[model samples]
Target: MGGQISVRGVTHVYTNRYTRETVLALEDISFEVEQGEFVCIIGPSGCGKSTLLYLIAGLMRPSMGEILVDGRPVTGPGPDRGMVFQEFAILPWRTVWRNISHGLEIQGVPKEKRDEIVRHYIRLIGLEGFENKYPYELSGGMKQRVALARTLACNPKVVLMDEPFAALDVQTRITLRTELLKISLQLSNTILFVTHSVDEAALLGDRVIVLTRRPGRVKEIVRNPIPRAARDEHTMENPAFIEYRNHLFYSVRSEVQVAEHEALVRG
Candidate 1:
């Protein structure tokens, strides 16, 4: 079953290692992600979208407030939460099957069971034939599919993605988006996806969380009106999708402008 996430008044601060200069990244940010919910977070560059994910992943501690996964406070990285990064962080030496089975191996699952799980995910990601292929031999999209399959094989309660599709080309990105949506629906995964594209957010998210400029705060949390089953290529042409996309684009653009101005001032 998917886990519910509760982020209560969370704030994060970063300090330059050498200069010891502190900067506020996220401020008083609070939100909730229900079990099996697909939540996408969008914000201006450096507005701490990735930072927020790290906080929830327990990779870093929030300066203030708390992040809870299924009612338990996040203290450090755990198997209950899985993260997929922009970079395809799969092992180059491992074949697609091996990469997908890595997590299950870590859990000490028997080879027979691990093989079964890995094969299932390979089919899930449409990489059945490429199971023997190494990372370098695969396309960018295929590698990401391997990475995602690896994460999903662990059966994490919540899946966190940090621009997982941002590195792909346009066509590949679109293709993977649909594949991911299908897989998510099939698995009923609880996902927290962070992206810079408003259209992507509109297409993939049950709710979109927009953040303000530096010292990022929750600007708004917009619920997607389009039903998940109805979200497809044709859905982009629908008026409701356009309206949601435009609303998010404008909201994010405003924050981007503010961030640029602040950068100029700092310069």
Candidate 2:
């Protein structure tokens, strides 16, 4: 069976010892991600977008509310949720093959089985002959490909990405973004991507969710028409592209002011 995610009214708050203050990271945030849906989250910096991702992944618990996957409550990190962080979280010491197979190794999959999946995804991510290369040997884009390949190798139910393409140069980021759409669709896994780019959200997400600032709350959920239409290069620069981008732009802009006001009160 495929996977679906449902995040109930979730809120996250942090207590600061030094300041003797309670910081609200996410407040009354609620949204649901259907099976095989590619959803992107965008907002101002420190608006708790990443906090929502961590809560959904069960890396940490929400101060309140519940997160569920396939009708089960998430209490801890599991194979069902795969994460790709921005800093190319791959280990430097391990060779490409070892890093990709790390998750399967943890679950004690047989050598033959693990090797087969690794080999398949190596080619899937276009890392065909770079098996023994170290992370230091790869370029920024290539390293991120390895990160994606490693996450996909585990066969997770959904992938959570936090600005996976944020660090690359202009040309590399664009090329990888185009390729990531292909890789994501071919793998057929549910994805929740977090980013600050309106263009990226419009291009990649079937629906884009915007959040308010710290103590983040869901502001709007917009369905991107292009991905639902004929998928092509020209579709992104189409007339609707500007319209969709503006919808998110204005939505996020309003939230940015809200976030700033909250920040001032807290400070």
Candidate 3:
């Protein structure tokens, strides 16, 4: 079964080693993601968007409350969840094929099976001919394709993306987003994506979770009415698309102003 996530009154606190001061990164954040749903999270800078993603990936524990996957509490990292970061995390020295097979290698999968799975994803992500190229030899978009193939090859129940497309150029980003939509539908993948772009969130998410300023709280969860099969580059011109875009833009704008005010006061 694909993963379903539940967050119950979760709060995260961070302490500065030098200052010995505690700051609340997220306060009483709670939400639920149904299995196979594509959920996008957006918030102002430092509103703990990435922190929340990390928390879900089991990279860290919440200071209070709990997170659960498929009714089981999250304790630490496991194969059930895979993470893709804004910075492509592929090994610099490894060729595309080897990088995609790294996770299977760590899990002690036999070389024959690993090769089979890696070859499948290499074709799935459109990196067929570039299998022997190192990270330094590929473009940013190709490197990210390697990162994604590696994650999907592990067969994780949930895919955690931390602004994976933010670093790509506008054209490349759009192309990949469309490709991702197709892949997720084909695989019925469950995903939780963190991004700053309202338009991107509106285009990609089944539901967009808006967050408040620092000490991030769930402000609202906007359900995207656009069907997955219907989304494409031209969908931006559709009235429904424009409405969703406008709504998210306004919702996040208020939080952006609040975050700016807080910055000025701190300064």
Worst 10-residue stretch by lDDT in candidate 2? 227-236
> Candidate 2, overall lDDT?
0.88
lDDT of model 1 at residue 103? Answer: 89
CA lDDT, every prediction? 0.92, 0.88, 0.92
Clash pairs for candidate 2: none
Off by over 4 Å in 1: 262-267
Writing each residue's lDDT as its tens digit, candidate 2 over 44-133 gives 888898989998888899999999999999999998999999999898999999999999899899999999999999998898899999
Our tally of clashes for model 2 stands at 0
Question: Which is the leading candidate under TM-score?
Answer: 1
Question: How would you encode candidate 1's per-residue C-alpha lDDT over 100-171 as one tens digit per residue?
Answer: 999898899999999999989989999878988899999999999999999999999999999999999999
How do the predictions measure up, each by TM-score? 0.97, 0.93, 0.96
Q: Model 3 TM-score?
A: 0.96
